[model samples]
Target: MIDEVVMLRHGRTQYNLQHRLQGQIDVPLDIVGQWQADQSGYALASRFYWAKVNRLATHPESIAQPPAAAAERTDINQYCEAPAAARRMVVISSDLFRAQQTAHAFADLLGLEVTCDARLRERSFGQWEGLTREQIKAIDAEAYASWKRHTGGETRYGVESRAQVGERGAKAVRELIQDPRYADDETSTTMMLVGHGSWITATIANLLELDPDGMNALGGMRNACWCRLKVRHTINGQPADRPLFELEEYNKAPAIADSADWENGPADLRGSSMPDWCPIIW
Candidate 1:
């Protein structure tokens, strides 16, 4: 059965660097984006070894600290030598170029193939697809004001509403868990869904029955970063009709890339252009 889900946001693109609305434009990853994806692959795989020693956050100290004593060293080496067949790792990605690129990186490391799903595409921004905030303000002042105020602006201007994005994304996830190939698996499965920012937030919120509107309570996830969720088929030892997910980690960057992160808790200038605010549409 699928034991866990990792929702990873795509690496940055030219549009992301420009602070423009990517929507369904399907932009390619920039140079730094490529580095982020490559490093994430190494870090994610190393977790199989580090997880027994450290928490899942992948913070700066995860790789820096040494074993306390000889016994601890032996334990870590043994954990690293565990048989690979104990678990299965798979990657599922949005059909968009950016998401697919990131997925391929992680899949290559695990020697797996990437399954692309169009439903995981970013929320359609309609007429604002390729425009920046400044351009949007100049074109449609009223719509811009409502969006800035976070009062359901996307519902207007032909853009896809939050509910619409949430519905499609959540359905995609639920269907995957029900599909026999994954749900009926003999070994535990770790499935990573590489997708866009807004779609990931909306889909997860909808899954958890939280408000999938405006700002996300879990906050914006950084580019090439991921959140861990535990998939449960039972509650209190009783079988559940459907799968339930528990949030284990939220918005954790790869420890290998920790040096690139700013003290402000965002990536450097070359990383994702997500401002403290322009989080949703971009």
Candidate 2:
């Protein structure tokens, strides 16, 4: 079976909190961002355990033998043996610091080495890097409007074209999937790719064959958010030219409750109400 690929967005950064365009600039995660990374690690570990349990439940007879024994058993009855623990999982990330840090958390949890590749870096914002949306509008109204409209004329400002970013990002992911070392194994394995929100989202949309406007409508990915993609094998019994990429799951975060009301006391401050102080993970 083809390995499952999990795509993750890096944890929050100072630029994220300030609503600035970070682009390829390197930024470290904030303290709260580290907490998010810890949570994501815990969540992934739980998923691994859950998958093991489900596999065992579906093939009760396989549990009677040791894992090593089951591996050698060729009986048709043993065909449903539970998948082995996914020890071969791999994690890859953008060379950018924030993405590297986020990938490290998962690598540590799984005891896997991370491979940093430049192709995974976020889309180059060119001149737009470090500027907030408001600042961009105030400073370069025409360029800002052009970007918003998805026009192809923004290259002069140094921002990468959306189509080019998607194509390049998808190419990198496809190369990993086609690597013989990953594809030859029958045991289920997983690979995690950590990158910027926009770049990852665009790459996913392209792989899923979503249209340009549909891709844009998919919106930005949240910090530490993930999307699970399943690659379907080809029907002709030949290696797939373009693997079928299906979105199995998407953006889920640990729940948080509002505590401001409890601390502030119940005075009806209706019209003058202030925003809650709860830390936003996205």
Candidate 3:
């Protein structure tokens, strides 16, 4: 099985700018979003390089470690380094246009191709597909209340349940992880999935074996941000039956100068108006 999987959220879209629910809409990336995708590509490329640098820095047989502990982890903060993992990675994306576009940028940078999968798509919001937060609150008060309460067996305007979306996303990822194409003796090969914030959130919770109620507990990834997960195939003396997706990091935006405000708005809105938080990536 692959050792690590990086789950990245798609870049910003017009809907995002309007603070609307995109759902499964095939919206294209905005100008700022495109720039974010490019920057994220470079950032993703640098990760492989930084990992190698860290290995070299930590080795007793290699050059002496840097004097500062903070400097020891091979900083590529400048974002000009070439990708070290140019090969040995399987890049996959949600079939939605935004995710595909974001995945393309990173895949092109790493000399790989994007494989599209519908299972990785964002949760469907049915009639609420492109509605803004205010619109949803005013028009569908009851649905909004149900959503906030996280009640099951009921969906607003036939929207897909978080549980349903998470299960689908989790199943797709688990199958991909078990694929033999990415396995290697080095055990450092990676799987990268570019997807929507809601879908990624649900997927992560599912991968961690959490129930539906815990789906959004960790929150969603911000536009162009990612979370790293580590999984093991075998444990103790037997093949692991139920593997654990250990979260290494969450909601990291390497390309952003300030990511403190890059949080999913609608998820936290909870039947209320949009918050004052805004993405500062641009």
Candidate 4:
């Protein structure tokens, strides 16, 4: 069974910077987004010893040399002593460019390949895809109001229902948990899913067997942020009862900011690009 599931939202993109709705558009990460992914990759490499091994394994000399070479090497040695069986790690990502770029950062650092899945893609906004919330309201007042109220199953241009997104997200989780390619007897296996904000939120809600609208109360997650959930499995490491998720962490960044930075919290540059039209609160 998978011991831990890490959900990472893709980093900033041009659309993200412009307050535009990205939906299923294949947008690449911008300069800041690239840096964010790199920093997040390094952080993950530090947290998971197996990922560290993968990071260091790229340099054969580092593996052969003694631990005294450098402080970083010393840190690597501290975690590399685990048995070979304990190092299993995998990265899965949405097929969207932003998500793929984020996954590639982790994959490059961890010396692993990325497995793309369509189910991990962001929920399509349909005709509302590129419009700002204000634009949507100006263009189709009824649809915009319906979405805000969560009362209608369809949007102005047939926007995806929350239930549809939840089902797709839930199916992806089920596939990962039950598919032999992802899960095994090894207890140390860690799976990382690189996806969009709405999709990740829905996936977590589904894993916990929450109702269709259950995630509304959780608020939006930030770009380049991640969350963790422990997976429960059968004795032999197979998929177990529903309620597969036990939340460990949610919407966390690698580093915490100083309290001084909170005086103008919403104005923080890191998330300043967030648009009011964007459903994500972060």
Candidate 5:
């Protein structure tokens, strides 16, 4: 079974820059988005290095306490090279261009192939797929209003609702758990899912049994950002039968500073507030 799941939203696209709804449109990543993918991939790869699980099975004493704490008892075989009981890594992506491109960056870093799945694709926005938000509002104000209210607008358009996306995504993951290729009691797996913002948010909300559509509920991930979950994070007993998860991180991107960061955007230089947040890492 998967112990830790890292769900990343695909990098930004031209549609993203124009504030357009690109649901399942197969758009590609823009320059900044590509840079973000590269940076985040490096950061994620470094996370495995720093965890020092690569030596867990052979030299478990090198790691203080239990190496399991760092891995959630999962196996990252290529990265960690642990025994059958160790952790392993798997990369999966939405069968969309944007998501595959993003997944490639991370997979290349890990020297792994990404498995694409249509179930992880963005919710089909149907006729509104290529339209900008403002354009949708102008074209059909009532439908937009219904959407904002988290009501049924799917009946009017060919759109897939949050519920549909959630169920499809959850089922895909459960099927993976039952698949012999990745799931076995001997190995804990660290799975990375590259997908669209809406799909990832809805899937995670469904797994946690929370409301993803509530006005103040789970928000969409920023382009190339990610959220981490402890899959069925249990203590004292075995993992849950369901695809349960506990939110560990959300809307998180690589904080590595570069010469290009904090440039051009007025929002970046407006003296941001930290909001009393404390992170485990300084």
Candidate 6:
């Protein structure tokens, strides 16, 4: 059986609202961001129901009551049996607060513990840590543009080179899979990795064997978006291989309403409101 992996970006942050480059900065989720995380948990719960349906169908004897009678059971416990011996699940996240928080939400829904791995943190921006693109241009326009165009260059401005980011991110993911907990599992498992935009994008591109230019064209990732991957393992003791880790989903969180478009005052607001604490990315 193959293992399934779910990659989720963190929720909105203060820097995201102000258009700042957050790289490695630890920021907490805003109120709306927290709500979105909760909603994500709910979505996972719905998926759990469908998974249960599939599992139950595979074992007819387990159902004492008739199909119609079982369907009428109000409690979800009737369908919450453990998966077959051939399946398992796990959740992990970067040590960063944002990623940790997002993983926490999903862990709650899956009834699994979250493991924070330091190797999964975002790329270190070095000197460019908190500056926005416009700000970087003002400081060193030529160098910034050159860095963007070139594949690898000197990190004079304290920014991480694209190649380095990709290398580190990929290494982290490889290490995680090699861990005994995941490697020894005979059953298929679902693993969720919550991390930053650039690092996650670079890792995905590397896993797919895409060139640097191709990854660049893919552009920035949106908050709370996710990617999915399926990794296949040999029935024998050979090393596991990933046939493909395709982009199964993209940006999907609910959009925040523009306050300026509202005719009524804030008191009468009925639409989605942006979180006051975090910066809105979109």
lDDT of 5 by residue, 1-282 (tens): 678888998876777766777988988986656767777778787775422343344345433444555756433344345343256677889999989999988877655668988888898898998987678778888898888788976448888888888888878877776678877666677888899888888888888877667764697677788899987745558754465678999988787633445111223322343122121120
In candidate 5, list every pair of residues with a backbone clash. Answer: 74-87, 74-188, 75-86, 75-87, 75-88, 75-188, 76-87, 76-88, 77-88
TM-score of each: 0.79, 0.75, 0.75, 0.79, 0.77, 0.72
Candidate 4 ranges beyond 4 A from true positions: 54-85, 153-156, 212-216, 235-243, 256-282
The backbone clash count of each candidate, in order, is 0, 0, 0, 0, 9, 5
Query: What is candidate 2's TM-score against the reference?
Result: 0.75
Local accuracy of candidate 4 as per-residue lDDT tens digits, 1-282: 677889999987878766678899889987667767776777776676566564354344555455566555434544445454345777899999899999988777656779999889999988878777778778877766777777763455867777678789888887886779877775467889999988887778767777656544456778788999987765456645642568899987766323322212233345655443234331
**Model 2 local distance difference test score:** 0.70
- For residues 1-282, what per-residue lDDT tens digits would candidate 3 score against the true structure? 477899988887878878788998899987667767767878887775444443333332443345675545544432223343223567889999999999988876645668888888899988888987568778867777677778842374878888888898999888887667756545456788899888888888878867667544776577898899987776876888855689998988864537433333323322344334365321
Candidate 1 residues lying further than 4 Å off, grouped into runs, are 48-83, 214-216, 261-282
lDDT of each: 0.74, 0.70, 0.73, 0.73, 0.73, 0.65
Candidate 6 has its poorest 10 consecutive residues by lDDT at 256-265
TM-score of candidate 4 relative to the true fold: 0.79
Off by over 4 Å in 5: 50-85, 233-239, 257-282
Question: Model 1, residue 64: what's the lDDT?
Answer: 39
The lowest-lDDT stretch of 10 consecutive residues in candidate 3 is: 78-87
Candidate 3 stretches greater than 4 Å from native = 49-87, 152-154, 181-188, 212-216, 259-282
Off by over 4 Å in 6: 48-86, 147-154, 215-217, 234-247, 250-282
Tens-place lDDT per residue, model 6, 1-282, is 336677788876667766677788888876445555655656664554443343444444454554664756444344555343245556789999988888877776545578888888887888878887778778887776776776443278677776678778777776777677755555556677888888877787777676645534456676666677776555366664643455665544433323222112133323465433333232
User: Any idea what lDDT model 6 has?
Assistant: 0.65
* Residue pairs with backbone atoms closer than 3 Å in model 6 (clashes): 13-279, 17-279, 17-280, 86-187, 127-158
The predicted structure with the larger TM-score, 1 or 6, is 1
Better of 2 and 4 by TM-score: 4
Number of the predicted model whose lDDT against the real structure is largest = 1
lDDT of 1 by residue, 182-204 (tens): 66567677778999888888788
As a TM-score, model 1 comes out at 0.79
